[model samples]
Target: MRFFILILLFCCTFKGFSGDFSGTLNGAFTVHILLGTQEKAFNFGVSIFGTSTYKSTSVEGGININISPFFQKYGVYQGNFAGSMEFFGLIGYGKNANLLGSNVGLTRHTAFYDYTKTHNFFYGAGLVAVLNQATGNLKKFQNKQGGLILRFSDKQNSVAFNMVNDVNARPFSKSGTDKGNTARALISYTTIKNDELFGVGIGLDMFTPEADYGVAPHSHINSEEDTRLVLVNTKPYDDLFHLNLFSSFVYQNDDISFDGRFGVDNYKLGALVQNIIHDNFGLYPRFSWPVTQKGRFYSLLDFNVPFNTNFNE
Candidate 1:
């Protein structure tokens, strides 16, 4: 857990920028090894979990978390929530579900799925609810809470479903609720780095949980419609010439479609040009890299802005 946090911090642009410290929707999943001491009794294991960092509109109208498969062989599915009551963080609370896996205990006498051995991968799921209210300013550490949730797991793993929660630092802070209850299912893909190829697959969006910072300062979701789609395309001609494209859509239920994430849909497209690759200017011809029989690490670097944001929405 600590290692993951360090990686997140290292990706930051640093302080003095007045960046958002606390958020309303936040979630994630991670892997865990059983033991690394020896091959005799030790083993390697993975963990899947998620939680909503915040959910409150005015009072925070938070929705459930959205979670899917990630990384390598990791499918996280859990429902949890946390949020502030006064938007500014005068009062806040958080509730997250517990995690379970195969033979999670160190006891040799107890066996997993036998109703013993503490924990295991084949086990079911559990729940844990919490509540906290802050007294002083949000910057100052001051909060408290108390709540309850309905969670259970049996000796035999039967139920197969996962939940995930996210944070909402600012209303509409994360336009992409990849997770959470805002929408049911989503499908997004990328062919090359520094490129835009995003799409969605909706299947279970009951009453998606999205925020509206407020029209006075901001604006709520699309009033007439309740659904929306986003598409992006980026083409960099060397370092100077670059192309960018973006498109969005919204509708009632069915009868709606847009460009796919892994391919072009033809809604938007953009580009930049330089004398040379980075010379800046001109219609220089660009060539493609030949297909190689070997495949290891394939990536394109963008010295201008190496990172693109589209987290667990």
Candidate 2:
């Protein structure tokens, strides 16, 4: 992890010194320490996320260290309509779901062209690498996969499609018996309201049972297909207080799947308090209420405090 971080830092430093660079950095760093309830039990965790843009490049790294040691790092390089193309890389390291079995590592690399100048379409291909350490009854697994990404967006609507297949791979389940590939399609639409937006979206995700592909090997439950619908409102407020609203419906083969940290779906509301305390500090709070299912409906009230720093040439 440290080696990879150093490599990213070196890229920034080397590029800055190689040319007459003029770049600006702007973004945020958030520290989240919160306590809540789930499944009728108390829970607490802490995490930190930092995301910033340096000119045409954007980098983000985040980790959760309180309950689970989950880490994600990503970088994107945007390009103009020239010989250069947009590139992206993402890496994730963590334990599998249920905190059992073995550790898992994931890496993805993609390069695409930006066609918004002519039309609202972008197409690309990517490679995925999965590494799972031996644990429980499962053997060590290593696999290399490839996929295609197709996206289209216009003023009021957007759609994305992804299909992945294993080129050469090993079994990904603990029993070494499961296999399959995956595909997903998501479509969404939004209407402009002043500077804010209101949107509705639907997603369909499918995993063919014998797919040798190792996407999410840790959480590899026997999922035939999953679908979801969501409604969203962005920047619903015009004052110093910032707010957003979301409501979702999840349809899954598991028969008992829903949204949130817990399994209960609700009208989710979140707020941000910023700028009054300091230029780079803010607090965020979120709440949810149950609407469809009953059982011990959970209510959580936790806050996040963030501080930001930027460096540019």
Candidate 3:
């Protein structure tokens, strides 16, 4: 278990996308902190939240503020609107410089008229932080950017599928012309035998249009994009043991993206596994070597705690 935890820490330094989101709804609130370097593999977003519902209605939101190598503040919200429908939004702002700002967006979801089962589609679009490269991790979150998301999920049986798409901007990227876009898809299956007895999930994420940090006043975006795919899963062998796995697919170009071009070219396959000894508290021991890319490999101990209850659980 410690081995896989070390690999997650070592891999995070190479290059990837991460978002820490949390918020509240109605009389209760929720929080989620998601950090990942691979495309879709081994991505766990924490949710510590609460909410109150009465008179045939509901509403809620979640956000998280993370202090890391770079300053970041992000959030996500969802609830009911009109009647038999739902609404959601994602927004945030961050600055490493001596500047401050604000931003906002909206998300919506409506369910099918199936009183016994939940069948619905989801869409999200909101403002996001456009970092300026100079900003360090110690800076506070600022609301000055916009982002959007769209997703659909339905649960009637033990198997369910979810697909999500999100896009944001980076003001420092090539004079702020290059927009960063991300796409994700996840399919999850639960067992009826024990509910938590055994379960598994698969996920994917792709990053396109390489984002740039304009170092020069006249810098412009260099057209380029890198792609990644991740596979994540969780299964319980017994009442006291659980098995987890994280894998990835990556592609980029180096030589072609040189001399003012998108300098990214490579390919990689990364996988790791862990055995949970105590739910949120567990050990992961794993290893990986980037193929066709120079991404580094390292190992670090991992610690996870629920600020509230486990949303995934």
Choose the strongest candidate by lDDT.
2
Candidate 2 segments exceeding 4 Å error:
1-134, 138-144, 155-158, 169-313
**TM-score for candidate 1, residues paired by index:** 0.18
Higher lDDT: candidate 1 or 2?
A: 2
lDDT of candidates 1 onward, in order: 0.19, 0.24, 0.21
Over 31-146, each residue of candidate 3 has an lDDT whose tens digit, in order, gives: 22223221111112221112212222211222222222311211111111111011122212221010000001111110111123233222222222222221222011111222
Candidate 2 per-residue lDDT over residues 1-313, each given as its tens digit? 3432532353345344434322222222323322323212111222222222333333323222222111210001211111101111222221111110000111111101111222222122222222222222111222223344333334323333333333443332332311221222333332223322233344332211232233222221111222222112122110111111222222111111112222221221110111121224332111111122222333222233323233432
Which stretches of model 3 miss by more than 4 angstroms?
1-46, 50-60, 69-181, 190-199, 207-303, 307-313
lDDT of 2: 0.24
What are the models' TM-scores?
0.18, 0.28, 0.29
lDDT of 1 by residue, 1-313 (tens): 2332332342232222333332222222221121111101111122211222222211111111112111211011212222222111111232211111111111111111112222212222222111121121211111211111112233222222222222233333432321122111221111111212121221111111122223122222211222222111122111111111112111111111122112121101111111132225332222111111221221111011111112333
Q: What's the CA RMSD for each of the models?
A: 22.5, 20.5, 21.6
- List the candidate 1 regions with Cα displacement exceeding 4 Å: 1-151, 160-164, 167-313
**Which pairs clash in the backbone of model 2?**
179-210, 179-211, 180-210, 180-211, 180-212, 181-211
What does candidate 2 score on TM? 0.28
